[model samples]
Target: MRKLIFMFFTVVLAVGVISAQDDLSGLTGKKAIKKANRAFNTFKLNQTNGGDDLKEARRVIDYVVKQDDTKEDPKTWVLMGDIYNGFSSFNQAQKVLNPDWENIEPNGGMVAFQAYKKALELEAGNKNALDGLSQIIGSISTAGLDAYEAGDYMGAFNSFRSILDIHDLLKENGAASPLDAEEEYDNQLYITGLAAMSAGQNATAKPFIQKLYDKQYDKPAVYDAMYKLTIDDDVDAAEDVLTKGREKYPDDLGLLFSEINHYLKLEKIEILEEKLKFAIEKEPENPSLYSTLGNVYDKLYQTNYKEGKTEEADKYFNLSKKYYEDAIKIKPDYTDAIYSVGALYYNKAAIVTEEMNALASDYSKEGTEKYNMKKAEVESLFSEALPYFKKVEKLDPNDRNTLIALKEIFARNNDFDTSNEFKMRLEKVESGETIEKSYFQ
Candidate 1:
C-alpha cells in the first residue's frame, strides 16, 4: 500500500509540470491580446533608450505573435505593424534571431515600412497604418532630397523614386481616405516637385504644381511656388501662370505682389508702375501697396546713390518719402513706413553734419558760415524726424535702440537737461517703474 501511494504522488507531479508548459505555449485569444498590449507599452517607453530593455520588450511581443491564435485579428496585425513601424533594436529581435534580418537593408525605415504595409493589407481603412506608411515614405523622400542637395545624384534618385512610390499610393487612395487628405496631397506634390526640380526636370515639376493649382486655385502660396519654378527657365511660362492665377484670383494680394515682383526682376519698370497704379486705383486705402511703392523708390535711390548720381538719388529719396507718407496717411498705425520716414531724415541730417565738419577742418572762416547753415539744416531735419521717433517710443517704450537714438539726438544739440531726462526715463522704463504723466505733457 505504501509503494502505490508514492507512485500516485509522482504521477500527479508530472501532470502538473506538463500543464504549466502548455500554459506558456498556448497563450491565445484575450490572453494573447493582453500580453501583446503589455509588451507594446513596454516597447514604446523603451524605444528611445535602445538596449537590453528594448530586447526584452520585443521578446514579449514575439511570444504573443507566434502563438498563431488567429490570423483574422486585424488588431493583432496592426499592432505588429506598430511594432515594426517603431522598430529599434527591441522591435526587430525576432527578425534578428532569424537569418532574414541579416539580409535586410541597414535602413531601419525600410523595415518599418514593410511592417506598416502588411498592416494596411490586413485592414484597408486603418488610419494608424496609413499614417505610419505615409510618414516612413515621406522620411525616405526627404532623405533623398538631403542627398541630392549634397550633390549625391545617385542617392537623390533613389530617394526621389521612393517618394514617387508614396505619391502613387496616395493617388490610389482617395483624398477622403486619409485623416489629413489635404496635407497628405500637398506634401506628396511638394515632394514630387522638389525632387523633379533637384533633378533639373522643371517640366516635370510643372505638372505637379498645376495639379495642386487645379485642386485649390485661390491658393496664393501654391501660385508663388509655381512661379519660382518656372520663372528662371521660361519667363513667358511664368507670366502665363500668373495671368491664369490672376484670372482665378483677382483680389489675391500675394499673387498680385508676386507678379509685381516678377516684373521688377525683369526690369520692366513701366509695367511694374502700371500694375501698382492700377492696384492703388482699385484699393486706394491700402497701406501695403503704398509701402511696396516706397520700397521700389528706396531700391532706385540705392542704385543711383551707388552710381554717383546725386540729383537722381535725391529725386528717388524724395519719392520714397512721399510714398511712405501716403502709406502713413492711409493707416496711421503704419509703424514700418513711419520708421522709414524717420530714417530718411536722420540720414539726411548725418550727411549735412558730416559735410560741415569736413568744411570746418579745411577753411576756418568760410567754413564757420557754411557750418552754421548746415547746423540749421540738421536741426530742420531732426524736427521732421522727432515726431516719428516719439511715436515709436510711445508705441513701444521698451525699444532700447529708439530710446538711445532719442537721447543721443537731444545731447548732440547741447540740450543736456533734456538728454538727462530722456536717460532717466529710459532707466525707469527698463525697470518697470512708473513715470509721471505730467512729464510728457
Candidate 2:
C-alpha cells in the first residue's frame, strides 16, 4: 500500500572512471590488488559494449579477493564492490533491449552490497566504498519498487531486505541511515512484511509483522494482518486483537467492515446501519457499503410490514429505496443493488394487491372507491419496478427471477404477447436447455 512508503528514485548511473589495462600473469598480494583495480576501472568504463574488460576484471578480482593479505585491505573490498556493481548495471541494461540476453552475474547486486559493507567494516572512512554504497542503495530501492509493481513479490522482498541489512549495519556503526526514524523504520517493516505475505511466505512474513506489533504500530493494517495470522492457531487471541483494533480505530474503514461482517454472521442486523453509515462516510465512492446499508433497511421493511405496522414499514421502505438508488448512482451496473430496488417495488405492489383483494368482498360505495384507489397504487408500483427488472434481464439474460418478473409485469399491463415470449424463455430455462453453456453459442 502507498508504494511501500519508500522514496522512489531513478537509480543514478553516476560513476565510472578509467585506467590503463595491466597484465597480472603472476601477480599476488599488493601487485594483485593493483591489477584488479586496473581491470575494474577499465571494465566500469566499457561493460555496456562488447568488451573483454569484464572478463579481465573478474579474472583478477575473483582470485585476489580470497588472498588473506588482500582481503584485509579496504581498497581491495572497494574494488570488489565496484566490479560487481558495474556487472549488475551492464546486465540489467542489456536485458531491457534483449530479454533473453545472458545475465553475466545474476547475483551481482547482492555481491556488490556485501563487498561494500566489508569495505566499510575494514575501514569506516573509505570514501570510494561510501560513494559506491550510496549509489547501490538507490539502485536496490528502485529495483524493489519495480519488482513489486511487476507482481514479483519475492524479488521485491529480497531487494528491500538488502536495503534493511545496510540500514542495520549503518546503525550499528553509528552512521546515518535513510530509514533511521522510527516512522520510516516501521513503514519499511510493514512493506517488507506485506511483500512476504503477498508471496505466500507467511513464515518469513511473521517476524517483520511481529516487530511492528511489538512497537504498537499505529496503522490499522497491522492489526488486520495480525488478526488473520492468529485466527487459525488461536481463535480467542484473534478475537482479542480484532476487538482491540476496533476499539482503537472505531472509524477506520477496514476495521469497521471487519466488525460489520462479524455482526452479519451473528445475524445482528439492527446494529448494522450506524456502522455501515460510518463506512459510507469513510468511503463515499464505495457502492458495496451503500448497498449493504440498503439491505439492512430492506430487512427492516419486511419485518415491520409483516407485523402490519404500515407507517413504520413505509419509513424503512423509503430508506431502503434511498440507499439502493444511491448505490445505483455510484455503480450503474451493480446487479445486486439494481435487483434489490426492483424487488422493493414489486414486494410493495404485492402487499398493496393483497389489500385491494381484501376489499373485493366489500361492494359498498366507500369500499369500492378505496379498492379502486388501492388498485391504481398497485399498478403504479408495478410500473416503477418494470425498468429495473428489464435492465437486469439485459445485463444477465439467464436470470430466472428477472425473466419471471418481466412476464408478470407485461401480463399485468395487458401485453399478453410480450408476457408469453418471456414465459416461453422461462420454461426453456427451467427445463435446463437455456441454462447450458451451449445455449448461448
Candidate 3:
C-alpha cells in the first residue's frame, strides 16, 4: 500500500514539472519582451552586484527580436536597445570592481546605437529611442578619446564616425543635437577625418576631408592633409589647395614648409629663396632654414660667377657666407654648414691656383713676381679652408669627403706626414675598418 501511494505522488510531481516547462516554452512575444525588460532593469539597477540578470535579458531579447509578433513594434526595438545599454553599463561596473576581468561586450554601446536607430525607423518620433541615442553619444565619445590616446586610430575613427552618424540622424528628424552648433559639427567632421586618415583609410577619409575643404575650415592641418590626399591624383589641384591654405594662414610654419618643399620639388629655386626667407622670419631659431638659404645663395653665386657677372656673384657669395655663419652660430656643431664654408674657400683657392699656373709661360721678373702674388693669395684662401675641414673631421671621423679634403689641404701646405696619415686613414675606412687614432695629433 505504501509503494502504490509513493508511485502515484511521483507521477503527479512529474506532470506538474511538465506543465511549468510548457508555460515557459510557449511565452508570447510581448511576454518575452516584458521579461527581457524586467531582467534588464534588474541588471541596470544592481550592475555593481554582478549577476546573471543581464545574460537573461540578452537571451530573451535575442529571441523576441526575430519573432513576427514583436519585430515590427517600436517598443520592442527600444527594449532591445535598453537591454544592450544595460550590458554596457554592467560591463563597466564589472571592470571597475575587477581590473583584470575581460569585457563581456566591448562594443555594447555600438550595438545599442543600432538598436535605437532601428527603433526610430519603426517609429520616427520615438522619444525613448532619441533619448537613448543621445546618451549613447557620450559613451561613444569616451571610447573614441581613449582609443585615440592609445593610438588605436581605426577604433577611434569608428567610434567618432558613429557619433556623427547619430548627429546627422538627429538633425534630419528635426530633433535637437548636441552638435547642432555649426562650430561643434565642423570640429567633429575635422577630427573624424583626422582619425580616418591616420588609420590609412584614405577612401573612407576623403568625404570628411573634402567636406572640410569645401566649407573652408579654418585649420591649417586640414589643408596640409588635403594636399597630401590630393597630390597623388592631381598635383595642380594640390598646389591650388596649398596656396589657398598659405594665404589663409600666412604665419603657419607647417604651411610655409609645405610651400617651400613644393617649390623645391619643382626645382623652382628662384621662388624658394623668397619662401625660405619668409620661413626664417617666422622661425628665426631654426638652423635648417639658415643652411637651406645659404645653399640657395651658394648656387646663385656659382651660376652668376660662371656667367661672368662678377658684381652679382660677389653679392651672392657674401650673402651665402652670411647665412652659413648664422647657421653655425645657432648650432656650432652643424657639420654641413662647416663643410660648406670650407668648400667655399677651397673652391676660390682652386680658381686662384688656376690663374697662378697660367703665368708659368711668362718668365720675366715682373711676371714671376705677379705669379708669386697670385700663389700667395691662393695659399691664403687654402689656409682659411683648413681649420673648417679639420673641425669637420673631428666632428665626423668617418666622413670620407672631409678626409679627402684634409688630405688635399695638408698636401698643399707641404705637410707630408699629416697628408699621408689622412691618406692611410681614408684607405682603412674604405676597406671597412675604423682607424684606431689620427696621425695628425
Q: Can you tell me which runs of candidate 2 are displaced by over 4 Å?
A: 1-36, 45-80, 87-107, 114-135, 169-177, 200-203, 224-254, 257-267, 282-286, 302-314, 330-333, 345-384, 395-441
Q: Model 1: runs farther than 4 Å from truth?
A: 1-66, 71-220, 226-252, 258-283, 302-310, 362-367, 424-441
Which RMSD does model 1 reach against the true structure? 12.7
Give the number of the best model, judged by TM-score. Answer: 3
Residue-level lDDT tens digits of model 2 in 356-441: 99999999999999999999999999999988897777777778888888889899999999899889889988888664331122
88-182, model 3: which lDDT tens digit per residue? 66666676778777767678788889999999998997989988888788777877876899899999999999999999888777788889888
Clashing pairs in 1: none
Q: 101-203 in candidate 1: lDDT tens per residue?
A: 4412334455556555556666675677666666666446545655677776556665655555545554555422232456765766665665666677777
Cα deviation of 50 in candidate 2 (Å)?
Answer: 7.3
Each prediction's whole-model lDDT (CA): 0.67, 0.81, 0.85
For model 3, the run of ten residues with the poorest summed lDDT = 16-25
lDDT of 1 at 199: 70
**Per-model TM against the reference:** 0.50, 0.64, 0.71
Could you say which candidate leads in lDDT? 3
Ranking by TM-score: 3, 2, 1
